[model samples]
Target: MNIRPIEINDYSRWFDLWQAYLAFYTVELSDEVTQKVWERLMNEDDKDLYGLVCEDEDHVIGFTHYFFHGTTWFDSSYCYLEDLFVEQSVRARGAGRALINGVKEQAQTHGAAKLYWHTDKQNETAQGLYNKVADLTDFIRYDIALKP
Candidate 1:
């Protein structure tokens, strides 16, 4: 019911939610890889990444990981919301909204001009919620993963 910035001590709970988020995306990254990502998120030098947790009685039910993106047109940097998820059983209860709005507040704190994120093309539920909070950008995200 409460949303707060993610602390180092909250990793175990955050990990559970993280795994669920990946599963939702049909990803199967190794735990070791995920741990490295956790380290990056907590690094003091990295102000670009901000993580938040949604909790109830010391249990983490959701998370939001956001950061800044360089943009030429705005006075403030663009806020890129990287990840957001709430446990399935708890959907429609506002945890996702809490995490997103918390990201919005953090973006404002960091002097960001706008906040943005991408959902899978088929993710109808999330799109519905997102349209209510922010406008949909016309851009489509494309990725080209590096090959070793």
Candidate 2:
């Protein structure tokens, strides 16, 4: 598998993977939001956001989207791994690990203070893989919807 930063020509392939990811989470995103996310990932001036693609010779099999942000507790920015997904057919083939490691390498190279992500409590499959590669934090996530 080849891991690389998403390029301008990868829109369709990237969108397919993004849709699969949303499907896994049982969510639907509108075209406007999807287009905006693509624009943000590809924006040259936005150093904080990025998308990485994992592909084989003939297909895009996985993707990850991440971003960095400042935090009050640390001087260096923290890396938030916002999304990760591998095609159902390609699971357990190391594509997921490659995409995650790709992000880790980027964080290290760019001097990020930390890298972290969250998975639904019911996602045991993902947790199985994650446990092997990263620590399982005890923190519980809380969210407030500012928009209806």
Best candidate, TM-score: 2
State, as a TM-score between 0 and 1, how close model 2 is to the true structure: 0.95
lDDT scores for all predictions? 0.88, 0.90
RMSD of each: 1.4, 1.2
21-135: candidate 1 lDDT, tens digit per residue: 9999999997788987798789888565779999877778899898898899987799989999998988998888889989999889889988888899899999989989889
Which lDDT tens digits does candidate 2 get at residues 7-89? 89889988888898899999999999999899999899856579898998858888899998888888898889999999899
Worst 10 residues of 2 by lDDT: 44-53
Task: Indicate the residue-level lDDT of 23 in model 2.
Answer: 92
| C-alpha root-mean-square deviation, candidate 1 | 1.4
Task: Name the candidate that leads on lDDT.
Answer: 2
* Residue ranges of candidate 1 with Cα displaced over 4 Å: none
